[model samples]
Target: MTVNDGTATGTTHGSMADAELVSTEVLLAKPKRVVREDLKMPDGRVIDWYFMDTPDSVMVVPLTNDGRLVFVRQYRHNLKKHCIELPAGAVSAGEDPAEAALRELEEETGYRLAEGEELVSLGRFYSLPSETNKYTNFYFARVTWDHEPILDNEIEAYFDMSVVTIPAADVFSRLAGEINGMETAGALMLSQRYIAAA
Candidate 1:
């Protein structure tokens, strides 16, 4: 199938039929924007699709020199619980994904790339294509916690952020249980492939 979005045309080879976007309504615009889209199906059916319209973000898996994984345990209001996950944050406008990953690692866990260390890009993935347009870049880096964390006001106010370290080998097992977030789990799984190849 081919789609012409007024500027460029692209062909998609897929079994599922495409839905034409009819209209869009902005539901919320603060913190993050929520949008509702009306679509017309190929079969003359109409549907409403709700999703978040936001900038891309980054997630970092920081491995210490001692071979430990750095994570953050933060309170998630939506879940009403503290969840452990990799350091992550939205990429500000005009900011590079790698830079955002490094900034988040420092801000969340006080870990910074040491001399000769680098932030390695694992690649990017959709946060949830069915629900949003936000894509998150995944990164891995060897770091050192030589300074105190400098939490942003929003994070400090909204979450009780605490840095946690664990053996890097235990990440897969912890992710299989309830000790990690899905995004972290996904990033770690991808990191395994990179580690294996290295």
Candidate 2:
């Protein structure tokens, strides 16, 4: 038998099927998914693995005409704290990641790219290979805060998010200290390389 582990698209062989689920539990299901599986390992060992099978997400490294980056300061329940992060959201089923990046930018920061402006593709990466199948695509866009963005006020009752701006020249140091979200930090790093070459 072959088991793909549902991580990537391809065929699996040999020991891949050795880890058969003995028991399963669903912890969360919705905008996000969390599940636990008890698998019997190849060496006749059994272990439990918790996984978050979430949709792929997009992170926008949005910049303004004045060389400032747009960010979101939102309260994260799991962390029990507010985090400064890039404007990001999940890619809806069958939706393009580039489109998702643009949508998330406007929804979260009220910033839309000016006419003819385009998004620079940074890259994509796995959030946590060991625990989650969630990967994030990074994008860089120059935005014009010219119009008001009609946003969902109750997107998440406790997750109230506010827009924040930081000078592009000062982003790295800030990320090193104040911005703790790894996804945000990774997006910034990827954007920096692109900005430098352009």
Model-by-model lDDT, in order? 0.83, 0.83
Cα deviation at 136, candidate 2, in Å, is 0.2
Give the runs in model 1 whose Cα sits over 4 Å from its true position.
Answer: 1-17, 193-198
Top candidate on TM-score is 1
Candidate 2 lDDT, 81-100, residue by residue in tens: 89999999889999999999
Worst ten-residue run, lDDT, model 2?
7-16
Q: Relative to the unseen true structure, what is the Cα RMSD of model 2?
A: 6.0
> In candidate 2, which residue pairs get closer than 3 Å at backbone N, Cα or C atoms, i.e. clash?
none
Error of 2 at 7 (Å): 22
RMSD in angstroms, all models? 5.8, 6.0
